[model samples]
Target chain A: MTLETTLAAIGPADEQAMAAARELQGRLTKPAGSLGVLEELSVRLAGLAGTCPPPMPEPAAIAVFAGDHGVHAQGVTPWPQEVTAQMVANFIAGGATINAFARQVDASIMVVDVGVKIPLHGGENLLEANIRRGTHDLAVTAAMSEDEALTAIQVGLSVAGALVEGGAKCLLTGDMGIANTTPAAALVAAFTGASPADVTGRGTGVDDETYERKIDVITKALALHEPDPAQPITTLAAVGGLEHAALAGFILGAASYRVPVIIDGVIAASAALVAAALAPNSVAAMVAGHRSAEPGASVALANLGLTPLLDLGLRLGEGTGAALALPLVASSVRVLREVATFDSAGVSEK
Target chain B: MTLETTLAAIGPADEQAMAAARELQGRLTKPAGSLGVLEELSVRLAGLAGTCPPPMPEPAAIAVFAGDHGVHAQGVTPWPQEVTAQMVANFIAGGATINAFARQVDASIMVVDVGVKIPLHGGENLLEANIRRGTHDLAVTAAMSEDEALTAIQVGLSVAGALVEGGAKCLLTGDMGIANTTPAAALVAAFTGASPADVTGRGTGVDDETYERKIDVITKALALHEPDPAQPITTLAAVGGLEHAALAGFILGAASYRVPVIIDGVIAASAALVAAALAPNSVAAMVAGHRSAEPGASVALANLGLTPLLDLGLRLGEGTGAALALPLVASSVRVLREVATFDSAGVSEK
Candidate 1:
């Protein structure tokens, strides 16, 4: 499928799905009408799949897409590009915050290894992957070669299809890349028309000098391609990383499969922006886990009409934030499935 | 117990509780640690209750203390005190937003006429209560007689006992009182040391003239009470509402039972200030449902160190906001209870 069509594939919340969630919510043992938006969410899921309980979104999949940004060579972040690959290993091994949270929530983690300039040999633990082995550096060229960008999205789509085929009923989107915040900031600016100042923020607690440099890199990259907002993937190409492309596709694949997707932090949110522009209704498939300290994240969420659940000053990327939100989503589903409705409980209502 | 001691009866989160939440979060089905705060909250609840799944806070009792401030006559609000009783009926009839959300979440709703001027009979749906049928005009005297204030709190405690006996694992607090915002504003200001201008906001959508008038009433009331922020409930007796006092006691009672209390909006959060002073740990039991549009609400939350979940432009008073947060709580519990651990999933961890 074409990249543009992939993100654009999601449709509005299905009425039948909502009815199913409401039906299950009505049957739960507690008060008939107590699980509220949770009921709405479950029923929407039900309608999406045209089934009750929406299959529990079981064997959930987290697509941790990794890629490098060209801007990092100019020193926007203190960390080196190798850290992205290192963190991906950290994610696969369950040492990172996302790994900890994923373990806590019981979600299965998939390290896409979407792009890392360093070739990943098939280590038994690490998923050997490379969408053109990272993007072309944005400082000198568009972040990714056009074919590489498409391949990166295909990698994400492949992960989504595999997860679905492997029985994952839900997908969680995560991203890892050094200096990703620069591209995320630029993407937010392009999509929302926010000033670079408004969308750029201290990434990894960067000092003022580094932050300004990051902004400069983003602004210069934006100027170079002047990526059209109307063509989102291309916009992602202008300043996006391989992970951004994969995440945008991963979100779309989940939407296409009629399963829910929970988005983490600014990097994932930036991808979500591109995804949403691709598919207006795909926003429904998304549940924003938390608002990160990253400036671009909130800009993307607001533009996408999402409200995050937590705000505990989290900046750790990976699928961790999304994993954290799993309970809230599961609660929405559980309340729908377990809470009793007015008629079942014989409770008097106005 | 002395009023101070009675208020001080509530306690903060103990170490055991936090640890329990963390461990339980590790076992839930979706991922090792995906649910985030929902997982944390559930496990914390388990530790607090000394159980694995923790009680589902069912048969939930909501205390909606309805009252009126004499300050309304000063033209601070465009609405009359009678609206308080009318809204009470709205709450009882399931016609309000709180009702919709509460019905969705399954918490039982009870209306307490703590200080309404009108004589309303209690039904099966209503909790028969009235703190001297409304307080003295705070524009001139102490908001209510000290005896009246104590009785109002006793009313809250009684509600807690009844709900607990009825099998509730949590106490949800809410309030409805006209021009009551003035007293709440005073209480919040006294505790937070915020200027009246910063803490006072339009209640029920007042015009600028009434807004200024509302601020003046609170500032004048603060002058009369000269409340010491260090002692909150005593400050409540001097300048707050009857319902506020009752809600404070109710919060303490729930904490004393180790039952989590979900504090609704500004009114409840304001009451939480008094509860916090009464029982320094009372703040531990609360879940701020939403940050209200009221200026004092955020100040109160900040002082109490709370973070609310919803921000849907709701400033309406009722346990509705808190009630809506219940499913989130439920979702947390389910994750802690249902999701499998790393050992079971056979997923290698870092």
Candidate 2:
């Protein structure tokens, strides 16, 4: 479906379903609120699914949107840009960290090459939907044309649709790009109204000099474009990476289908900012899987009023954190579906 | 094994294995320390196993120790003591919250009637090892005699050995005792030197009046017993539940076998404190699964130098938090075992 159609279809979570879940939680054998955030999470899932005890969010699908950043030329990170393509190959070969985590969580991985500078050959689980070789250097010019940004987003939407159609009950956002965190910082700043210094962080272990230069690059891009948060498209086009745009679309697509989407690190968080801006109700579908070590991630999550389920100091952006959280998310829903109530179990309540 | 043998068997985690793990972590494809606490966890597991890649902690076993606290007569909790045996029955029937969580994590449940005031009948997975009908009210006198406490601890050690022999790679602590948190708070105060009010919390959602009375009960117990931290048995006999004593032995038993144990909420944390005191090296085998909503849990964990993997505001003491954290604990080791090195993956380092 088109972006407009998806946004139109997305609506607020069902309040009736949330109330039902809350009621069910009180009836459960455990003390009220003893499950803590899990109780709220289950209720939120119910609201998202428009049912009490939302369908078990199992058989998770992870969409790793791989791309390259022209800003990598600006020394935003110490790693060479070629590492992005290599990691994608590693992901395809099932040797990457994300691959191992996916195997542990029993999640299917789909690698979508949205704007990798290096052309990759055919590989199983790889979807080649390159919108461009790479974007323009954001420090020098707009990261991409508004049209190109929209195209990448549509690519994400298509992938989300395909994954859901393939029977994925849950979606996880994964991203891979050299120097992508620079754009993520910029996007987070634009959407959350945070300053460059507050939003920028050490991406891939940048040195002091490279970190300063990365901040300068983001500041320069923001100054040059003067992006408006009210207009998410222009903001994304101004400084967002191809994967960032696509991730936003993927989130919106998942929301349109009323499926829970577990967001990864800073890259996915910034993209979620874009998606939330576009469709306010899309926040209902978002689950902050883990708080990244990246400083900007906390700011973005705070702005969205979402608490991450896991905080393992993970900054690996290839959906490792999100994959780790899949079981916890499933457990939250399972408690609502499978747990016996106080009445049913003949247990006394305070 | 006897408690003395288990304590003697428990030694410090291998430093050489931890160093090797750290070296291997640097060679992984991801940036150094990018895996966050997970890196440290894997390294810790390596040290515990005395190997670079520790054995996978799977086929988890959750031992839910059920008892009734004589403190129930002191009006510390609103719920009746009979609820403890009822919940134990629920666990056997696979209808309790812990059962739901155990099922979600693919863990085997073993319900041990350690000191339940009421006798329970035969059921599969139920272990009838009652040390006493229940402990004496701590506020009035010693919770139990030194001999009874030792017997309960031996019960726990026996259960741990049996579960390990049955092929449980990980052991999770679970406890069920009405008015148990009062004893847990007393234990925390004795070990951590924190005041009773600072450590005491509403157990099972007590009202304001009941909370104040709970705190008073803990304070009175601590004052009456004058429990000493160095003399752990005396302290446990003074104000600890039978489940708490058994849980301490269970932790020591796991450490003796070099198997990791995921400590649950406040009850488990208090028991861990007792275990750590008895065998200082047992701390090496302990993993704080989650920070319980109960205030005392943090103090106990801090004293143990253990940072909980999750802080989900959970206060359910049925090993739910530990069960929830099984995947994360497994993922940490899996990364060490499965993820490729940079050289192996042909990926560049920053």
- Most accurate candidate by DockQ: 2
Clashing pairs in 2: none
B116-222: candidate 2 lDDT, tens digit per residue: 99889769999999989999989899999999999999999999999999999999999999889999999999998999999999978999999998888888888
TM-score of chain A of each: 0.91, 0.99
lDDT of 1 by residue, A1-350 (tens): 55556655656776766676665554433324333344455666677666676666656778788887777779987776776766665565555555655655567887777778766544444566675666677868888766776777777777787888899878998877878888888888888888888899876677799888888887887788888899876888878888888888888888877788888899989888887887888877888877887878998999998877656456767776677667656655554454344455433332
True contacts kept of 1: 0.00
Q: Which stretches of candidate 2 lie above 4 Å from their native place?
A: none
Regions of model 1 farther than 4 Å from truth: A1-145, A151-243, A250-263, A276-290, A299-310, A317-350, B1-61, B103-108, B119-125, B164-169, B190-195, B222-235, B305-313, B324-350
- Separate clash counts for every candidate: 64, 0
